[model samples]
Target chain A: MAQPHDRGPDFLERFVALLEGDDVFCVATVIRSDKPGMPAGSKAIFLRGGGVEEFGFGDPARTLRSQADRALDEGRPRIIALPEGVEVFLEVQRPPARLLICGAGHIALPLSRYAADAGFRVTVLDDRPEYASAARFPDADVVAEDFIPALHALAPRLFRHIVVITRGHAHDLDCLGEVLHWTTDYVGQIGSRRRLAFIKEELARRGFPADALRHRLYGPIGLDIGAESPEEIALAIAAELVCVRRLGAAHAFSLRGRSRAEAP
Target chain B: MTDLALARRLLQLRRDGLRVCLATVVEAAGSTPRDVGAKMLLCGDGATFGTIGGGCGEAVVRSAALRMLASGQGPGLVAVDLTQGPGERDGDVCGGRMRIFVDPG
Candidate 1:
């Protein structure tokens, strides 16, 4: 039986909605194979069970659903090769992750613009009301509150890529101390080499494992772009954000003086 | 284009009751213009959404998709071989083979 691809809310709408929202879903697409059952473009979306709402869609094959389940569980996209050259591309997709700008400094304005344009849900946080006003950041959500309280509010849910570009070194250290505990992939700070080294030493003394700080935190953040102006620095940080989001565990080290981010 | 944009376009097509075939590069081996997951939509009225590495190769894929749409058949795979000798003349040779999944969807 041939069925039209439902572009209505029944199928594509839900797919787009899920993509725009927070729920993580896996879309399993049959790429190629000698398998006679499914055509090449046949696809199915599987949502995680238990509290994650699973809506209408004629039930998919158990095997296909389980494969998608595995993909969702692993949180990685992979090509599943069945016996006899059946190739299926299982894409684990979610909405663009939220980028937390810890300080609403000069860099924060351009950073928010660049990050939002690059498909990040940017949130600008600062204790200063003047700086954290929504007018300053049209593209980002502004939170006029102290750093730790706001971070605490955001600590529960994942998908946080924090940039600690506070006005002063002391505030930067304070923000770093709070966010270093989270298991997020990115926690970048802007400072000179000596300032960063001092902050790292302080963090180490404060009982954050030295290796974890070294690995998780990107001190003197931004790729080696020799950025001078605030806008250029913001662009570099935005590039680093994409680098960490896309190239996980590959460029997963301190990005200070690292390779320039490739333009998309 | 992002999948969201494609979905929005698809929804518009659905509203307009316009038929279309969606072509996706399911697999690409060796040097190819577009990699896997690249997509293009060929509407009934000879309009296109996005590009599958725009060239003669895309034109061929578009023709195949139109054929599939006319036939009212389900999704099918189009094996595009770009490894032809220079004299055969697409002029743009990438020496790669791409399997495009064309769905009259």
Candidate 2:
């Protein structure tokens, strides 16, 4: 049921309160429209458990609800049609995307921190207790002192993204060998050009199909953003993850040089 | 997947006193990937968690989020129709109608 406009918090106030709630919710804003009543930038909120809280000055909630439902089911976002000239912007929300970084090394440190700051839930895994300490990855949602088995325990299907930046090529290969059959949204590895080639050859020798290996592997891992520092490289890797999800893995390689740090 | 996680994270961020905007699907129709009750969260600094629709739908909301964060005022209810544009005319054949609510959280 819709709340009365006068007594309840204005659309914005209620929207803010809803966003603050622990339950996941999606937000849709009318950025542009063909009609006059719905002004640009008007917004709404959709919840994960199949509910919604909306407060905006634009199109009636009824008109937008039809569109919102479709967006939620498709696991994507889309514009909605209302009447002849009205339009609404819909965005979806779910559990924070998780990244399973299977190594707690120098690279993992900054990558974990950056991923957390970038709004991803970071989890670290390493066989070394010294490197897996919470003190090292304070921002990580979890830090484990075991690599392959711990990763298996988490159930690879639940992981949204996976990044392998272990100590050396052998370790990376071992991790890949254990997890190749595990399903995940995205999988990537960090290594030098030569090391990447070596790992691929080794995997193929060990029976990993050349095609599957090629499709799953993202080596020298990250967008070619000319990233040098850990933070910069983290951004590139993050960018690649975003690209793979947004544009699909097939298009990720083609989006090699486009880096828009500008927000919006 | 990412959208839901992002929304939850946004909620956590607000515990520290930051303001945010949330979007969710209250209704949907036809052949679409997401269903009713999908959500996406938008933090004040352009940090977002979730998906409503990808591409233009997300981009438009991201732009709107900047204002929502800046104004400190919520716009209340918002909606978007996916079938209203040319690119979508040829591409998104999901034929499903959807409604979204954008508010400050």
Docking class of 2: incorrect
lDDT by residue (B7-98, candidate 2, tens digit) is 45665677678877776665677654467666688777777776787755566666776677788764545544555545554345455666
User: Candidate 2 chain A — worst ten consecutive residues by lDDT sum?
Assistant: A255-264
- Per-residue CA lDDT of candidate 1, range A29-122, in tens? 6656565655555566666672122222223334566667777888866677765456667777767788999889899999999988787888
lDDT of 2 at B28: 76
Name the candidate that leads on lDDT. Answer: 1
Proportion of true contacts reproduced by candidate 2: 0.03
DockQ of candidate 2 (2 decimals): 0.07
Colliding pairs, model 1 = none
Q: Which consecutive 10 residues in model 1 chain B have the weakest lDDT in total?
A: B1-10
Worst 10 residues of 1 chain A by lDDT: A50-59
